[model samples]
Structures are given as structure tokens and as C-alpha cells.
Target: MAKSPYPVINPGGGPMGKVIIALVLIAIVTLVIKYPSDAARWVHGLGSVIDGLVDFFRTLFG
Candidate 1:
């Protein structure tokens, strides 16, 4: 038998994985829609934390 030329999407998980991913996406969408301001603030705070980490690493190694 010949191997597939196309790439496989699922890494071999069953339908449960697809269902869980779909549910998580739906929940995220719901939260964003229900709390737009909170979501924006949370994202901004996350970006700040990531930026701080980058600065810390730069000082540590550079």
C-alpha cells in the first residue's frame, strides 16, 4: 500500500478529541462575546506579562 501524499490533520486521536476542541472553541467565543471588555483587559495583561518575561530573558542572557 502507498503512503498518503496528503498530510493528516488528526495525530491519531479519536472523535472525542475533535469534540473537545470544538467545545473549547465555543466556550472561548462565548466568553469573548459575553465579556468583551474583560477579555480585552485579560489579553492586554497577558501581553504585558509576556513582554516582562522577554525583558527579563534579555537582561539575563544579553
Candidate 2:
């Protein structure tokens, strides 16, 4: 079987990592859903950081 390019992330894996990722994703999604403008500004403010993260995921999954 081929290994996944992304980390072997078990959604229900270790409690702490799961919780943190869940909360971060929730916060991002909530911000986007509730306040699109603010979300855009926040992402802009953290421009490089956000870009790096996006790139990281794309690389991991691509």
C-alpha cells in the first residue's frame, strides 16, 4: 500500500494534538464564516505565516 503524503494523522489520535488542531480549525472556520472581512484582514496581517501554513499543507498533501 502507498503511504499517505500527509502525516499519518489519525483524527482521533493523541488527545492534545487533536484538541489543538480541532480548536485552530474551528477558530479559522468560525472567523471566516462569521466575519469574512476580519478573517481576510487577519490572514493578511499574518501573511507569511498563513502562506507558509498553506504551503506546508499543499506540499504534504500534493
Candidate 3:
């Protein structure tokens, strides 16, 4: 079998799986290029949500 670029993504997986992932990555990159501001807002929103969750868990346990 061919060596994968990132083994963690598809451990013991095949070339077909890699091709599908590459296509999905390409699509995402295209989307980000088309809508950079929207993507930035989305990523920032996700970071804030994750931060809120961490703070909540810390207050609950700490």
C-alpha cells in the first residue's frame, strides 16, 4: 500500500479514502477562499464556544 501523508486521519485506510479526504479539503479551501470573512467569523465563534465550555467545566470542577 502507498504511504499516507497523515496517518492519523486514516489509519489502515486505502487510497480511495485519501482521495475523498483530499477532495473534501479542496472544497473547504475553495469555500474559505471565496468567503474569507465568513470563515473567520465561524472559526472565531467556534473558538469562543469552546472557551466558554472550558470555563464552565473549570468552574464546575475547580
Candidate 4:
């Protein structure tokens, strides 16, 4: 018997995975298009929070 050249690590979740991914991509695009400013502010706030945490850690250690 011959073995498959490309083995199937995950045999199932083929079409379903594609569909879920497509839906998620569509949602993200729609959000970016509809709420451009809101999205930008949200991302900026996230960056600020991360920077504050880094500063706090540096002050604590050094």
C-alpha cells in the first residue's frame, strides 16, 4: 500500500473553517469601514495602555 504524500493532520473542518474565516474577515472589514474613527481611537487607547504597563515595569525593575 502507498502512503499519502501529504498527510491530513486535521481531516475535518474544511468548508466550515473557510466559511467562518470569511465571515470574520467580512465583519472586520465592515467595522473598519463603518466606524473608522472609533476603531482608530480604540487602537490608540490599546497602545497607550501597553506603553504605560511597559513604563511601570521598567521603573519597578530599574
Candidate 5:
């Protein structure tokens, strides 16, 4: 029996799925790297995105 190289649970998943995630992460990272504003803006944007989820959950629970 020839064992299939095709993964049942793909480590990369599909091409599009990986690409979309990579792009979003890249966008945020690029914002950090090349923003015209101060470091505060970059830090705030990154912090907000990460904290946004937590704030949402707090509001939902509260």
C-alpha cells in the first residue's frame, strides 16, 4: 500500500489559509516597522489589537 504524502491534518493547512494569516501578521508588523508616527502610535496599535480581544471579553462578561 502506498502511503499518501497528503497530510490528513495539514501542518500548513491550505495555501490560502496560511497566506491570509501571514498577510495579517505581516501588516501589523510592517505598521510597526514603517509607520510615520512616533513609537507610541505603533505600540498603541499593536497593544490595542492584542488588548482589544481582552476588552471585548471583559465587556461581554461584565
Candidate 6:
């Protein structure tokens, strides 16, 4: 068998990764709780953008 040349490194490999993820989750939850309407609007706008892109591609190919 032959060995590959590259070495693998994991970014989120330890307790620090868990801490970072938890902090991010906390921040997102805080934002949603503090500004529910704004978060909803942002999500709606993202969906609209995705829908528009899909429609554009469908029209272009069809």
C-alpha cells in the first residue's frame, strides 16, 4: 500500500472548539430573542434570494 503525502489537521479538535461553538450558539439565541422581527425578516430575505436564483436558473435552462 502507498501512503498519501498530505497530513490532516482538524480545526475544531478539542474543548476550545466546543466552547467556541457554544458561544456562537449563545450569540445567535441572544440576537433572536432580542430582535425576533429582525431575525425573521433576515431569514425571509435569504429565502427570497434563494428562490430568485432558482427561478433564474430554471428559466435560463428551460
TM-scores for all candidates? 0.74, 0.48, 0.69, 0.56, 0.39, 0.66
* Alpha carbon deviation, residue 48, candidate 1 (Å): 1.0
lDDT of 3 by residue, 1-62 (tens): 98878747555378988888899999889889999999899999999999999999999999
Candidate closest to the true structure, highest TM-score: 1
Greater lDDT among 2 and 5 belongs to: 2
Candidate 5, backbone clash total: 0
Candidate order (lDDT): 1, 6, 3, 2, 4, 5
Model 4 — which ten-residue stretch has the worst lDDT? 8-17
Steric clashes per prediction:
0, 0, 0, 0, 0, 0
TM-score of candidate 6 relative to the true fold: 0.66
Candidate 5 is scored at a TM of 0.39
Model 1 lDDT tens row, 10-58: 6647997888889999998998999999989999999999999999999
**Tens digits of per-residue lDDT for model 5 on 1-62?**
99888847556678977888899999877876787476577678989898999999999999
Runs in model 1 deviating more than 4 A are 1-12
Q: Taking the tens digit of each residue's C-alpha lDDT, what string does model 4 give over 1-62?
A: 99889876554467877777789999988989999998899899999999999999999998
On lDDT, the stronger of 4 and 6 is: 6
Residue 4 of candidate 4: its Cα lDDT? 88
Report residue 6 deviation for candidate 6 (angstroms): 7.0
Per-candidate local distance difference test? 0.92, 0.89, 0.89, 0.88, 0.81, 0.91
Task: Evaluate candidate 5 by giving its C-alpha RMSD to the native, one decimal.
Answer: 7.1
Q: Better model by lDDT, 3 or 6?
A: 6
Clashing pairs in 4: none
Q: Give the better candidate number (5 or 6) by lDDT.
A: 6
